[model samples]
Target: MQFNVHIGAGAVLASALAAVGVWHAYSSGWLTPAKPRAGLAINERPPEFIPTNGGVLTIAWVKAYETFEKRSPSELELKVPLGTVKVPLPFGETVSEVRTAAKYQYQVRLQKRWPIQCGDTQCVVRTGPVELAEPVAIYHGETERKTRSGWARFDKAANLEQLNRSLGLALVVRGNEPRNRDVGMREGRVEIEKFVREWMAKEAHGARRIVVLYPGEQMVDGRPVPAH
Candidate 1:
């Protein structure tokens, strides 16, 4: 077709072409993946793509925090010593009786070891079966005796908030979330499985695609995709 076009039509065509180019740039993984919170980098890899709200104390805690139990094959998850668990100290309302029990020492252990590059060749590796993460103990926090009713009321208000927090998700395009840095895999394929699992767990009434947008651009699995 060799039809001559007017200047107005030419302008519209140019604009349309530009828009198409932009759309492709967005989808071809041209844009960088979001950066996760800092200090959370495992084995020097920054994995910011995790969208979960870190359901640490939620139903998924069993899953999210279960790395300690599983045998990881990389430095993505650290086998750290001295992980803390809050233990409620029970005592009387008055301070006299509680003072006697405060002096005793309590021990807790945290363990999880992952694989890593050992040397020049594939020689770098864990020698035998997965080694256990180190265990260490620290003094528990100061004991306080609030009434069972007092704690019940506080937990009623606080625990319910935790229930809702599990439903929330975060798109950390920049910065760090050092607390869970260990969850990110270096050069590892994106955690699409986690995303899909979480989406399925929700009650979606109806939706064709679970699209996410970055900086006003629609994203397909965090990579920009064509919107229409």
Candidate 2:
């Protein structure tokens, strides 16, 4: 016995069309390209965490000269917003406020540290770096700040002015994405929060992280919480 197998012209044409569509999509980066994904987690038996000494931290945002150059954040930068600031004494020991700027370079005034009596001749009152609760978003331009009519800045300024002596926090700006800056700030804030949570989990310090996001302008734990 002999058997014959045949395929319909319609079926062959449909397959060919599907194959071409896929090829076109792949070449156009619709199917072939993959977006970069970020993952966050705590490590087991992580190294000892050291806090940056000082009651104040200065944040500066500079434009990137080369797009290809990798960003090398300092130890303070990596461990911040999650790391504690080593403050001394009962006088102005708490963090008062956190600030950020889009200017190329700027200086911040931190509280003066206690006097360290060196030898017998002179006593030195030195100020060190302040621990950051979160990494500041330094956009290439003031696109977000300007577009929002400095709404984010206004929030920060208000929060800092009414800041309490107990808790310190970095504001996470979220809400509508009318532009690119809005989206950038939102994503950056998410990453910063993730980094802090990961550190709290991995570091062996046995510390708990508490985050409160307010929908509007409201105070939580003595700090102003901004919402979307």
Candidate 3:
């Protein structure tokens, strides 16, 4: 009978020790329930979606004008008994005027990615740069050309041909001027904002505000700060 009583006491004591150990572990967090991994919970939110349609986006178009001119000097002169007389020469001047409509494209290339930051209510997208598309479309029907010839000048045709040949390059240079680029960037900003808003409506359903930053812009205090 004593042996059985001792055995019962031993079993009770073992149970009490096990209970105390478990309580200690729980208090120390070792026995607490594990935390769910990131993005694995029952209510996990989806990632923010940004659309990059495999290539560049045409954001805006700017109109520009360029004029090319060339002049050849008259070499013929008449010498009289009293003095020398100057005569009008042919083909003395040529002018070629060109008007162009240039397209500006925006792209987020792999080398320089546009960074996008998003919150529960707003999203900010930073753009890389705005560039003029190649082969500026010239308004051929609106182009004007003029040629003048002096009675003594013989290079009128050559001068006009040269001016015409250089028109394409001149227009390209004019289209890329700082003034035109500034206009394009301003217009592009509006288009980009609109695009982002539309994208948010479809992809990031809860975002309410969209801010777009140009190459030299920044966000400060939830407002856009223009570059100096």
Candidate 4:
């Protein structure tokens, strides 16, 4: 009987010790479920969304073909007090012509300050002046030259050579002219509008309708018009 009682007491003591150990572990947090790692939690917050504003935009080279022609004087003239006297030259007149293809680049300075107005679903953005991104590029490989010399001309070859040498420089000068720049800008206007529309759609703060205006243009009757 005593042996059985002792056995029962031993079992009771063992159960109590195990219960105490379990309580201690619970209090120490060793038995609690592990906390999620820093970024591995199922309920982690996401980053905030931000929209992008456009930067500088550039158009690739636009191709243009032009013909330049020059005619040299047939005779030398001597200036006098009252009038000029013409003296026939040994070499007659030389007419030289060159046909060349040039490439021009256009750019929009979006990074600069530009006016912007927004309505409920529409936005109007005034862009900077459309400008040349680089000097005109002439394709020499495609240059075509024609020279015609009069019957007595001896320097036809030399005249043609001089024209050829100055062709590139002359074309560059012509391309920089105001009228030529206007033509180039007009040529690229459609593409520039399309590009701006697409870009504004992405960056104009949920604007569904985008209107772009270049320099020297104004909003007229809800449309764009060239400023006088």
TM-score of each: 0.15, 0.19, 0.62, 0.56
Question: At residue 129, what lDDT does model 3 achieve?
Answer: 69
lDDT of 4 by residue, 1-228 (tens): 355534588898999999999999999988997777631224544322223355656644566788888788767533434446544335457898889888766776654334455555555666667777555677889979888887666677788888877866776777667667777666566665576566566764564565567777876766678878
Residue 128 displacement in candidate 4 (angstroms): 2.1
Tens-digit lDDT track of model 2 for 21-86: 999999987896554442111222222332335343333323221111111112221222434674
Alpha-carbon lDDT of model 3: 0.64
- Per-residue alpha-carbon lDDT of model 3 for 158-182, expressed as tens digits? 7778877876676667767878777
lDDT minimum window of 10 residues, candidate 3: 104-113
Residue range with the least summed lDDT across 10 consecutive positions in model 4: 43-52
- Each prediction's total of clashing residue pairs, residues at least 3 apart in sequence or on different chains, is 10, 3, 10, 0
Better of 1 and 4 by lDDT: 4
Off by more than 4 A, model 1: 1-63, 66-176, 187-228
Candidates 3 and 4 compared by TM-score, better number:
3
Off by over 4 Å in 3: 1-49, 74-81, 84-115, 220-228
lDDT for position 166 in model 1:
28
Root-mean-square deviation of every model: 24.5, 28.1, 11.6, 18.8
| Ranking of all candidate structures by their lDDT, best first | 4, 3, 2, 1
Residue pairs in candidate 1 whose N, alpha carbon or C atoms collide under 3 angstroms: 26-224, 27-224, 36-48, 37-176, 37-177, 38-176, 38-177, 40-181, 79-112, 118-124
Alpha carbon lDDT at 4, candidate 2: 93
